[model samples]
Target: MDQTLSPGAAADYIAAQENKSLLRFLTCGSVDDGKSTLIGRLLYDTKLLFEDQLATLENDSRKHGTTGADLDFALLVDGLAAEREQGITIDVAYRFFATDTRKFIVADTPGHEQYTRNMATGASNSDLAVILVDARKGILTQTRRHSYIVSLLGIRHVVLAINKIDLVDFSQSVFEEIVAAYRSFAHDFGFETLVAIPLSARFGDNVIERSPHTPWYHGPVLLEHLEAVEVVRAAASRPFRLPVQWVNRPNLDFRGFSGTIASGVVRTGDPVVVASSGVTTRVKSIVTGDGERPEAEAGEAVTLTLADEVDASRGDVIAAAAARPDFSDQFAAHLIWMHEEPLLPGRSYLVKIGTRTVGASVTEIKHKVDVNSFQRLAAKTLALNEVGVVNFATLAPVAFDPFAAVPQTGSFIVIDRISNLTVGAGMIDFGLRRATNVHWQALEVTRQSRAAMKGQQPVVLWFTGLSGAGKSTIANIVEKKLHQLGRHTTMLDGDNVRHGLNKDLGFTSSDRVENIRRVAEVSRLFVDAGLIVLVSFISPFRAERAMARELLGPGEFVEIFVDTPLAVAESRDAKGLYKRARAGEIRNFTGIDSPYERPEAPEIVLEGGTTSPEALADEVVEYLQSRGYF
Candidate 1:
């Protein structure tokens, strides 16, 4: 049934559609920056409000607005009672609007430094930014920080709204000075364009409509630019690509692949290829919500009918037959550490690229990119919130395109198994094929063979401690105790691991990370073989320890922290390594030089030197026994 939507409904529908030109924009400014007032005024002056919405605002004003100044304009969007009382947005709020020329998806970002993660969440996928800079404060640190984030997120377009012009008496010189400073500072990054507009969002000077008060300004109003500026779009003039999201099989015989076309276009009978298997097939038909299309363009979420019932499922990308995606088990990419935890090399994560997720590890961190200047600094690892160009090698082959070419196929996220949090975001840059001549072969031993050979259940007893602490001694005794219990066990001493499996690793920050990682994986294998694996290492970083704990099932990898004071550890001088570290012989050394983040909680805390190694090892078995691990 064909029906005419009311103007309000039309506006809402257009703003919500997936096919419409949605300009993802973000608003960033500190408290008292008039950011909320600006958005409120824009909605008010644009005639986007309904009578019911306005009536509710009026009643709300009369009921709770103590000052009673026409509903506190900011209250229109900041609807929370606490937000209304405090007059600040605590979280990122998404709102959509539209003018005659274009549609907008505005992400109101938080200003506080502590909420930098929230700000990044909003700006991560933004195409443009509306940086609200108070005319009085000019450009503050928060402004610079938000701008840096916008650039880092690849937001090319920026609209610098020099708000609160009323305070500056509409001073052109002040506005121009601020503009010049911002342009100079921001020109260092990939900010494609910047449009400076002078306006008072509270006074509605240049938001929805132009004001004669600012005669000196010739540019269109805020709404005018919003309606005119094109949201930088990827043209559909490339090869057709679609990552199969789901199999649409309403019946057994009839089947179809459904996904949003990420790029290019697909037409009826067009030659299509499955990315994983490299099998070619022709498109039988294109099914969309609006019936079938002769050709489906980019950004259209449509179900595709194929010529054959080939083995295709989620994660398999379908593209034009002539072109093939980059297929490899390993690849190099730039990663942005998103979680509160630091990223170290050799840590494995489930990499989710498009619909495909696979186990991946960082082989090397080629360099860290300076988001402000886009400089590629040679670094070992990327800390949280730091963007770096790092190389990752996955365990299985996956398809990818360079981020510069395909944003959808190129992007991925890393899931930390410990916290189940998305720790990083990556963009593909290089594809490293599996080496056929490398001759890398994993063991083919059965679980029965390995356990019978060892004589006991394989479990990873992870021991953490400060340098010079009696971790190795305690672990050695623990292995002996386990052997006496008729349980097969192996002592993976920290020093021993550095000489064998982790031989190539060094004490460098990134290398130490990889070192612990190699040991953890070997420990996992020991557990699989039904033998208790005792790992004694500093493993100073708490986050890595958490990862090791998560990799093992509940009570599988037992963390025993050899709790010893730093002074006590330094005084031990068992290996004289702490003395060497104090003499500047070692760099990035834990305890002596580098900071050791102690574990807040561990299964057992054995005092180093104070407790007998035999007693400590016996306690470990008792603890495991209580937990039913024995």
Candidate 2:
């Protein structure tokens, strides 16, 4: 009888074999540490590559191999043309292979300092990590860096692969010394499993099979250890959380909330509540692709029909009624900066987590990590590839759990508004209780009621320009005019505020942002009281001004640009600030060392050096009156 099965049976057998438990891991080390080579050797020894792929690899090795007549296994994992030419991996390359016991997915991450972001991206979804170190140069800075990152990402299992042991003649004392050094530094990481293996990946020793070179070692081979290590399955036994990704309403008669179960389980008739709105309803049915089901577990995609219609939509979460997650508008998170431009604290970005996106800003940088030394350093802003602990403030409340409890709802991406590019990734350490504790106490007398009593509309006239741009002079005139007209008004002069409210702030870019933030918050309070607030400041950044505009009600915030040439402002030098800035006495002074971003389209523009203050004030008042402010 023939042993081979038919094509149809073979397809079924292959599909059945794919149902094995999977392990996802990554290999990270310094440049020339042989990470790609190790991954390539694993695939080759496991017989995962096809004949044509091996043939091509052999040909490529002849042309590009550093070792003559030897197969360059690294060529198999380095997929890009540039990577092949440079003999280095630039991006994260994922490869899949299966052993008889378990399936495996391995990420070969770049080892360059500039590609730290790529390494982080690979670690985000991995269950374990392999920190490879060359035995000749054991426990370098890159090894510690990779270990720190994998721990930050909450990977419990780690394998310390000391490769190139053949170069050291497979010395047991060297392997023991390196293992002891790594354990001393990484003991505080709290890894559930840490295994050390000494082998030479270039020779395929102790990779798929045990090596005779390490006669002193009694542990299982690398493949055996990988297959036996136990990793926690994601969110399977925790509280139920399903972030609503879509609202399925094909017809008027049917409605369902569709999302994959992020954690725990759900069954028909289970009591569920909306995480954002807190509306309780029982689950009427659980619908899956195969049709209605009795129950749905974590990682399963299903549509849930509620017994009663509620205000649930995309970005909402449906959780078991008895166990609901915390909701807050503020959180402390670890931010990995990924962009070339440094992060500006007050600048707003669209933060996305699960199905929701909200306007958020990094309010404060607690500290940044020095990856090389593992030391915490005080930093005002984060540059590319830097990691920092930051306080984030969102415009609206979002439901989330601690990353340790559930990763799906706790991770987020920060996208630049103008560029629509991801600038940072954040992991929510925990939500700040103050965010929910500090609630707006409702009062019978509100902004509308106050405005009605005053018989005028509340407004904030934001006057922005260079240092000597006559903004203060024009704002003073406007306040005087409002005072004469029997309207309630107040002026927040920049210099006056700096004398007290912002005394600690300086001329640095970060300090300037905070200064504007304080002024805007105070202006908001004044507007709520139904008083016209005149904010005169050289708030140079356009993003800061835009944030102020968003803080106020529609049409309440008016941007008035004081257009004055730098030469004119310099010549005037009313307070000698420009001259001092030129003499290097004042650093980060706008129109000198720092930048002054002119408003692209302002409600009012005054040629400050040419136009009279009274005229400019009259034009502002005219704009207010035209817009029905009085």
Candidate 3:
């Protein structure tokens, strides 16, 4: 029997010890919603705080900087000093505590509606959730907002913590009414457990210690329910899963893989395979900080050395190989759009799943989940704080399970390399069947042969500018002049290419990068086949264009920057995009919703708006003539 245990710890621990419980959960409501008051009362009444910590709280209360007396529990949840005074959980702050019965990790989340992304982060790995609803108001819009996120993250158990019962007159009828309303709203989510309790977090009514004030009510207190429920163990029982974290090698000759065991047990001589490479090896030994172990189970941090050498490294997962993870290029998944920039297709993002990271893109937007109605809006895009199911296609193969089958393995985050912020979080739906089986056939003409046929060195001329800048205008005249001069050339215009090649793509930063990549590849083939390739596009990112440069030689690639200032380009207004952008009709628009970084040190600078179209075309021809193409 597990001896030293708190009601909170025992229930989660017993579930985890048997590979059952491995996660803890907590919710933060708005600052006015009693989030601090509830957590503070629970710790204070349960005697969890150290004497020094309690002393500090008392001392600080007397000299109070921001929070008041009688223990502002938000202080305990806000792990950062900046957050404590600010009076909000900025993001997800994890805390660990233990009793003799079980150990637990708690996810403390923010309450504001705008920080829904942070809320998603808090509950992403949780097995259970406790939503703090003010007793006086019963349930606010934020309550439903958080609950939707909790359900989306796949947390099974949800406890409706109706806090500040003292303010609600401790009325049993009000509690019942709130419960009924919550149940009705919650019915759409399809959660497993929904337990609503009446309590004043300031007074510690039913949080840990049973309250005599509610003699009329006869149900197990919040603490009793937490200890008695079985969730962690259930999760552990699903399958053996371990996400390879880091390649461990203390010495040159000692090679091992180290990661916290996500699920299941492993013994020496167990056969395992690296998912990325499919190399199979037998486990030679399992070592932990505690000492050498013959067997390591789920949740234990261990270093595993194999009997055979393999190219296993970071972003690779080791598993039974028999139970292969769900694999496909495209699948449906839920997303929390965190970035201010909206989502669009043909954009590439680094998908960090488990320990593996790869290039991925949202190939299609199926629909957005309507927050108010819970109805799915079959839209092409999603904006900030929106929840939606988008189709993702990976550049390389990925090993994963459905977010439902394995939350840790199925989960992923999209990071913006420029901003260095996690822009999105997602869960895969393996059964998200869609049509994406279009085959691409390269043109029969190869670049080396095309260059020989043209009687001049074939090259890719990439022109970039704002959407309406003279890119297409200049590229058209350049192609016509080259045609009349009897020189071989192929012009790939953004608008013409959009009709067939990139028809499926939309206007988003990620999509634009992907669009440029596809166009770049085609240009490389043209250059290789001996034909001069002319490409006109608003290739926005320097990094993406740099990739194009990497694919060709100095002579074979020429970067022509259509140098038109934003103000000048807007005045031109060749298309209505500038007007629409200014009107806020869209978001993340290049030069408006999103920032467009101009090319630095481009091979050629063309004054797109000022120079005559034919003169710009003549300038390119002269450059070609100097290269002996004429």
Candidate 4:
């Protein structure tokens, strides 16, 4: 594609391009802001399109082009059939091209608000962002949202591309006004460089070459600035960190830790510590696929052999002995909720950082950010595309550096345990000091010792169903039967606990999750005290039930589903609560206004409609006896 190179110099051109520094960036903005068009224009001006590709673009443009009789450059990038039909980018599209100076990989991200997750995905890997804005519509909400996400994801460089300038007759005042408004809101974004450029993607104006129409505008063109911008390489200067991805033992004689170096440099004989266990060892050898290496810096994937036989495994961070990353079970972070299902605080999720996945929950939602005003507003849950600061509590401690210092080891993704869908993304701020300060005191008397003294196995029987589904009645009978059998037992009914322990909580979804969380913790304490605890609550969400189940050891927590049809439960209306719910008097009433998620695989399924409470209680006792719970 280089015009200066002759046909005989093809190898020379290829070699020169191979050595060019690569810059990764993305184009993002509000809908109809010409993100795809700008990328298409860049590819076209760089002369990277072949004859067949150009011809296909021309044919597709005739069918789907918004610009009449003009080449629809968007067709080059909007390759999805649905995208062509809807005339909007629904997914992130990436393209590669090279100028004479630098090779580039640009991502054309979607502009619609619903596809904001896709934009965040693109921004996560990019070093710079080109945020397009319609010259007519200045500083829209989506623009601000994307800008906030860009800053949150730690992109230091931004180019405010004011597209469709020709539509506004290339007015300098319009450009200045839009730039001023954007800078006003983005003042706290902390970007190192903010460049403003005016261009019309539909036409060739200040795209690759300077335009004569903008005589008043004297600045480097888009391509010139992209090539000249220097992206900082700060990872190599930070503390040495390598998240152990795999324990490589191809043969019994070879033991190596394989992972890409997350930060800093590692050399042979360097003292490294397992961040979680505090076990120290020296690097005996650095092995790569190509052979041995003396030293490797950040971003290099190598296998490290330790001098001493120390305990190190996947999910452990190997760091410099003098400077170790922080390890904690509790921390605060900023979360970007990406799924349609709102983020509930107490529900259990799988948090994946580096190669380690742990059970985690949002302990509290501090506040959600109003992207337009940059104000923190009180929020109990985070809806789609919402950003919030939250405290996360993991089942076990994880080693991480603050995202500001080392991004690779500091960011995590939240995955739904049931669906395995990525629901949220977050960046670690810092570990909670309280988590580190508080230590678990070693008690001589343990749960096993207490249960042996009582001559019985301690367990939790959890009852969950609709409000009028006989959950409490069956659980009460089960507890009485167990007590009559000379077994130590205690009951924590939902209503009784509400009057004392959970008196301040309500019936909202968030409150229900917290309510179950508190009851689950109390049940665990009772189990530790050598008593069979019966917990009866309509723990509606399966995620919350799963959280409770994970808190206890194997076979200690038993879930009982009181299977009663909604119509039948409402027909009985034992407490007359369903009547108020049906009359719109009570809000968030389960099985009436709110939802009740049925347990997929509960330990016991009691027929509340047909079976008597005594019969159900007998059935539960028989099952527990058969399982050797006596």
Order the candidate numbers by TM-score, best to worst: 4, 2, 3, 1
lDDT tens digits, residue span 466-489, model 2 = 888889998999988888888889
Per-residue CA lDDT of candidate 1, range 1-630, in tens? 879899999988766664556677878866667776777777778788899988886787676553357555565677777666776776888877876556788887777665666777888778888998899999887787678767656678889999988899999998899999899888776777789999987778988778787889998888888777776577487678899999999998778999989889889999999999999999999999999989988889999999987889999899888977887887888677877657877776789988888877788888886654556798877776677777787768898887767777888889875466888877787676556458656778866577667554446778888877788878888777766777767778888777788888778777777777777778887777777888888987766777677667765767788887888888987888888888998788887667787777777888876877778878888887776655
Give the alpha carbon lDDT tens digit for every residue of 494-563 in model 3.
Answer: 8889999999977766667778989988998777777888999888887567767767887778999988
Model 2: runs farther than 4 Å from truth?
Answer: 1-8, 62-65, 81-87, 343-347, 363-383, 435-437, 480-487, 563-568, 598-601, 604-619
Measured by TM-score, how close is model 3 to the native structure?
0.80
Model 1 Cα shift for residue 402 (angstroms): 1.9
- lDDT per model vs. reference: 0.79, 0.89, 0.77, 0.93
Report the CA-based lDDT of candidate 1 relative to the real structure.
0.79
Which candidate's lDDT is highest?
Answer: 4
Model 3 residue 595 distance off true place after TM-score fit, in angstroms? 5.1
Greater-TM-score candidate between 1 and 2: 2
How many clashes in each structure? 9, 0, 28, 0
Residue 314, model 3: lDDT of 76
What local lDDT score does residue 385 receive in model 2, on the 0 to 100 scale?
A: 83
lDDT of 4 at 503: 98
Clashing pairs in 4: none
Q: Which candidate is the best by TM-score?
A: 4
